[model samples]
Target: MQIYPAFHIDKKITDAADEALRKAQPALKRIDEVTDYNQQKMLAAFIHCGVSESHFAASTGYGYGDRGREVLDQVYAQALGAEDALVRYNFVSGTHALTVALFGVLRPGDTMLCVTGLPYDTLQSVIGLTGDGNGSLKEYGIHYRQVDLKKDGTPDYEAIEHAVQPDTKMVYIQRSRGYSLRPSLFVEDIEKIAAIAKRRAPNCIVMVDNCYGEFVQKEEPVAHGADLMAGSLIKNPGGGVAPTGGYIAGRKDLVESCSYRLTTPGTGREIGCTLGNNRELFMGAFHAPHVTGEALKTAVFTSALFEELGYAVTPRWDEPRADIIQAVLLRTREALIAFCQGIQKGSPVDSFVLPEPWGMPGYDCQVIMAAGTFTLGASVELSADAPLRAPWAVWMQGGLNFHSARLGSMLAAQSMLEKGFLG
Candidate 1:
């Protein structure tokens, strides 16, 4: 039966979606289990922190002794299994939070090692991988080095061990797959890397760009040995409700150092004002695990449906997932555009808009994006984006609910079919 009577979806596509749902049952069930565990963890943190109506009250200028801000940090720290956390609406993005951690921990003579190869496009300039060194880590005199991933797109453990130096102050790991075809790093992988780095240099900090990986698994990177981790609130912890912010959680000392960087060296985390954002931030954190589960189900369904349609999908439907991203190799420019446009069409907001490829800043080439979310640029709200380059693939993620996400995936297929991009 055609489930979406309001829109046109080919019978073949509908049938494929049904079969895909069937194939995704096991994976969906696992997502539910993880969601339950994470939800419980979040609940415990809230209750233990004594989160109440008072903590939701806003603060103003200098925000001296803001109870909500302070308790927000405690709640996040407890939830992520970290010694401390810095949660702030001032953090413009996940990259900003990571930058604070990097600058806060490393000195001019120190070295930073990346075990996950090159980072996301937005981080290229920050790390001086692209563009002039200007204000990047490179310009600040801190040495940066990367050990490329192996041929199979997995971390090169041997290379990482050899790469760590006596002067290495930080070992970086990006938990998400980014724009690459590599697998997302799980907490177990983080544990091994942390162990290896600490063994080589006892003082080295293992930092994870936890971005899209938050709440997707039963445990976070901090629980498995990461000394520090950072992520954007808009992505996962936002629960599709947090207006804007980011978080950094990990070792107490390291988190303290990051706080200094986030504000001023002397003031640190003590003075940030929550203004009118405390309630939504708290509410969002409370709902994150469940929202993340919905996104995971959407990703699994996408993988299964795309596979049924003969496209290659990473972490195929039944495979274990470490993040919400679902990469589908459309293999052609037209198909990619069609898929993104279709996703836009299925969005609750701005459904009539058409997305086009443009030279977005912080990227090497033209990139296309489709996001009609309530929150701008929220990847946790069913958005598809891809760089216009070789091996064209669309990275899709986020869906507040499974039903809406499933319909979006089917609409993507329908668009491709109408354009004859699908066989």
Candidate 2:
């Protein structure tokens, strides 16, 4: 049964959460200020494009004359500080958007360099490391090279210096840690690495896999120097409203090329109807900044709570947060399962369901995901996932409301205690 906080809540944990909320007031205020700035910018994009009620109408057949499609692109471009953007419900997930961006800019025989160590696991197959029996990048003749992060998990600048050669047509940077223990990259870090890529390989396109890193900060990776950026609508940009989609924003030509890849050679951005998703897209963009603030606060609270309980957390409570994600090193499989199961207890969607680790595809090991989101796989609506591998970590992200997220975290703690993993 679901434990409603209205009557059956634990006073001790609630009191601690209240104290934490009080301590986080200042950071929350700063978040609101930046959110307002971003909101205004997005609104201006809508106004500039002359959005109308009919823009929300769905279209069919090559999606010709879809005004809503155009406006969304404009809104996303402005919001992400890019010259152009392609925001569509068609691209599916973050990985699909990233694949389009990579395929659009990279031709056969081009070498791609990853400066931020290994990328998210999903990209491994896309890059042809695995599942390359089909039309993978390497199957098309693209070369891939990686400059692993230093022992301390920082960018390997010397390795990057040596790796950015003439044939390196694309240099990749993943802003989020993505199953890794390293801290997520902030704009400053993106800038530092982007500058090196530009200086060494001036013609090489610098692309950022921007999943889970949008709207949490005022500025985006495009503003830092990335030539192209890609992310999922269900993550941060959707503002917990958009049902499904992905976005690619950056330089005009690069964005256009991505659109071409998304559609076809002659079609490009001119096609792909909104399919009645315009309203959700606009509303999501408008609410993304505020929603992101809530998620960030929840992450802050989670960090402090777990740290107080004697467990170490990556990017500690008051660290410079670049994303909503908060990783707790549980160190044991028993603790990991119990912790995630506890979070499921507070979920409105599946409060009674227990999450178990399984062999989820696109990942090496059995992974567990606690995604009781309002929109299926919406990460911005509060969710958690971690691969049941060596580190035995639990990665938590998003919180529609801080209170709800707090309850989940507290429940997670209680579950661990009940299992004797912690007491």
Candidate 3:
């Protein structure tokens, strides 16, 4: 006998979801094709690097001559089409990896230009835009400037060309949309930005924040022209398995510099220990492409469902996706809360817990989040979150598998309907 009662999904929501799936067919096919190509690529990387069972062994303090650690880096470098890479659990977050890259390449008198306009909120403190100036880029005497995106939310190529200067040591590109409504950048966009940066400032390094953008398409930023890139492992690349980590991949010399920043200058990538996390990390890399495809499908389904329910959504069901994130504009605080609560309810873990808005450390506004992931804050699993502000948009990403993700999205809509937030 079944131990638990079957959960109810309203007929209205189910009907809407069925319609949304019909509309999402084309996008789903594209995702499958990309997944196949990326899977082959990842397999090639593993074979090329000669990944073996012995490579999964752990090392302790000092960790000298750790073969597994070295091979892990090689596999990532091959997979990302980078000359070198630093993959470590020690880096903590995507922001930390980005910070290391920034401090590694820049000097006291150098300037860093952001072509994607102001970055996400968490980066503000690192760039010295918010918080006390302690250890920020500005405090270290690195100048910062940005060329805002065009009114249509595309990069201002001409403006970027003009903005590059002799002292511009790094050109920053953010691949994900962050909390904004603008479209996330594609690898082609990164290539163009890199070409412009190299043309205007030959010595400048083109760096990309690749979070949420990996394995979505056939090519990564490094393959297209970016000199360096960084991301959190807990996102798409983690395959929802890696407990904690981040990666920086790029030109060999630049990667070495980042390694220096990650550890002490003399120690660099040579010293850190894996502490038995190697197996999960390697397994995560192997499964990343498929998991990312699942997330993309879920995002598309959510987009179509919300659109069917008469709400605005970014990168509609049939649109080409650059990342897994799906943004739904609820337009009211009550609806936003209800949608998030619904997502929490549908979660496999902590289904009964009610999520509320609170002052999250990185953001300027009170943020509400619902994540019942096995690994806390793992965005590769089904999750939804939003800041309490105007337009009331909730950014949803990750679905380890499409079936569960679709149900979670439906529950969100059902919650809104139950509360009369939907017509």
Candidate 4:
């Protein structure tokens, strides 16, 4: 088989991956061992928010009372392995959860040094970039500073330390790239950031935006000594099980504060007596590990294949994958669209439809996607997206099962071959 150029997987790594793939083939052959891809796609379509089921399910005699809070607390603790994880199906978005956490922990006039430069694209609006006529941290009087990423995409520790001020109440670190110019931050990098935060200012909160990076690494940020870790329910942590929701896990006090900020003041100590979809969130958390692992494998394989084909693959699999995203630089608008169309056809999300770039609200330019039309990011089916940029690159993410990802990848290659672009 031909290897991709951008990935730089040598003979040894390729051999190891091959052996692992062969070993897994038999185990994967059992239909009962895996969830159906089409079923997952259908589930993705209906889930609008983490609270959808709560909106529909008949109240189980558990009003927005103590019982509801207890159920939420139990579910959160079970999913995160943190004694004090705060899982709220109510938080509308991952940014909402992070904002709640930040607002809860940082007092007004307190500084929030951004250890990881600008956060995800959506968050840029929230952090006061243009205000863009939106509410954000700046509106709350939270001062912000940034430290650019290192050559390998990790944060600069010394620069972070320099940025720290006496009034710094929180140090924000984003694990996933989050629509930034930099690449993803690795687990070790997170640990290092935690160490710096602890050494320079023990009282300062160490928070991470663990969105797409959740469960992709062996150890979570909490394990690496981060004070708090937050992510979207629609992303990796949802595990194709959480119809909608996001999560925040970490130290007891901080999590408690975040819980309070998530709901009405004084209501944060417990899962607010608000109704929540406990069953779906619970199930999604249960399957998260395996689903995230499959997505990671797909990313690795796709990255390697595309790299071998002479495309520029970011976060090249020379080292362990930081997350499930594999961005292939197509360098041409025509090629990028073709690549996305092929992946979309393989997806259960509107398989017959072709995707095109169109203007989206809250963004500067038109964006394109090739999956089911839902907002909460739950499309586990294979798809690709790219912002219009010079040397245009299409970033591909997701595949509920490795088998489907493998097939999609081969089809992508076949598409390229048909266009005579592989030569």
Clashes (N, CA, C under 3 Å) per candidate: 1, 0, 0, 13
Candidate 4 lDDT, tens digit per residue, 1-423?
A: 345554333454355446545544443433223324422432442342232334334233324444434545555554454557776666777888887787778876888888887676677777787545256778878778888878867678889877776557888888876444367877788888888887788788888888788766555777777888887777777777676677788888888878777765675654343444766665676567677767766776776667766777876644356667878888787777777777766665576787788886556767777664233356444667877655577777777787766656655655655665665
Candidate 3: the clashing residue pairs are none
Angstrom error of the Cα, residue 165, model 4: value is: 2.4
What candidate 4 gets wrong by more than 4 Å, as runs, is 1-62, 66-72, 78-81, 269-276, 373-376, 418-420
Q: What lDDT tens digits, residue by residue, belong to model 2 across residues 292-386?
A: 87888788888877777678898777677888899999989889999899888878898788999999889888999887878997888768889
Per-residue lDDT tens digits of candidate 1, residues 73-164? 99999988899999998899989998989998988878889999999888889888889889999999988899999999898999998999
Q: Which ten residues in a row have the lowest lDDT in candidate 4?
A: 30-39
- Models 1 onward score TM values of 0.99, 0.95, 0.98, 0.81
lDDT measured at residue 195 in model 2 versus the true structure, 0 to 100: 90
The positional error of residue 399 in candidate 4, measured at the CA in angstroms, is 1.2
CA shift at 49, candidate 3, in angstroms? 1.1
lDDT of 4 at 329: 80
- Sort by lDDT, top down from the best: 1, 3, 2, 4
Worst 10 residues of 3 by lDDT: 1-10
Candidate 3 residue spans exceeding 4 A from truth: 1-5
- The 0-to-1 C-alpha lDDT of every candidate, in the order given, reads 0.93, 0.85, 0.92, 0.67
Error at 50, model 2, angstroms: 2.6
TM-score of 2: 0.95
